[model samples]
Target: MKIGYIRVSTAEQNTIRQEILLRDLGVDEIYIDKASGKSTDRPELKRMMEYVRYGDTVIVESISRFARNTKDLLELVDKLRQKEVEFVSKKEAIDTTTPTGVFMLTIFGAVAQLEREYILQRQNEGIAIAKSQGRYKGRKPIEHPDLKSTVVQWRAGEITATAAMKRLDMKPSTFYRKVKKF
Candidate 1:
């Protein structure tokens, strides 16, 4: 069986290109994740791993799309290998069933990890510069329309705390914290 995996960094990013390529390759099933590859915590990725059987082939658009760092990439590949599954990366022309492909994967995985580290370093530097220049205001607070009324009602005993929390769509801890601020 051939299983395809497609991923994009955010929900807004399209998976069409990867999907089309995987479909063109005649994959039987496709799993997709619309989240960061920085971690291997994606739901679809986990599902695909568990779903694969022996003699199955896992097809990916690229190494970076599969994993953000060498450690994660290698670990995932090791898992697949243990299950007797093969890995194929379309962009890198890597097929882990061959010896040369395995060697190439290691080199590419290292390069991917290095690239991720550089990206993080540059992002941190940019943030530090922005902070020093007083341009970074940080994330804006969420404004809930009924929060004030709900908190007031909860405080005044007109509504139960649980009722107010339900109305505000907040957990007990969040409700109490906001109550303190108000």
Candidate 2:
């Protein structure tokens, strides 16, 4: 079986182009996600991986669609290899079933790592400069004034976690995350 995966950073982004391209490659199925590339907790991506069987192939528009960072991309490919699954990237024109493709992927992983490191370095430099100029301001904290009351109610056994989450209008993860920082 041949499966395709498509991903975009936001709900506003379109998956049509990627789907069309994957279809052209004769993919038997396509999985999609509207989430940031920076996040590893992609539910759709996890589902796609779980759906694959031995000798099944996974296709994507490019490495970027599969992963944002080199570590993630490399690790995912390694896992797929263990499953006897082949990975194909249309834009890269590389298929993991070939030795040459393995070589290319290694190089690509190195480049991606270097790119990530460079970006982090530049960000650090910019932060230092901004701090030196007394203009550095860290990210603003999430605020939900009603969250405190809801948390209190939940803690006091007046409400369930679900009730507190509903009252606060936040997802379970969001509620827990905010509660931790709140």
Model 2 C-alpha RMSD vs. true structure (Å) is: 3.7
lDDT value, candidate 1, whole model: 0.94
The parts of candidate 2 lying over 4 Å away from their true place are 36-40, 69-71, 134-136, 145-157, 160-162, 170-182
In order, the Cα lDDT scores of the candidates are: 0.94, 0.87
How far residue 113's Cα lies from its native spot in candidate 1, in Å, is: 1.4
Q: Which candidate leads the pack in TM-score?
A: 1
On residues 1-182, what C-alpha lDDT tens digit does candidate 1 reach at each position?
Answer: 99999999999999999999999999999999999999999999999999999999999999999999988999999999999999999999999999999999999999988998999999999999999999997888656899888878777899999888888888888788778888
Model 1 misplacement above 4 A = 153-166, 169-180
Tens digits of lDDT, candidate 2, 56-123: 99999988788877778888998899999999888878789889998887777667667767988999
Instruction: Give the clashing residue pairs of candidate 2, or none.
Output: none
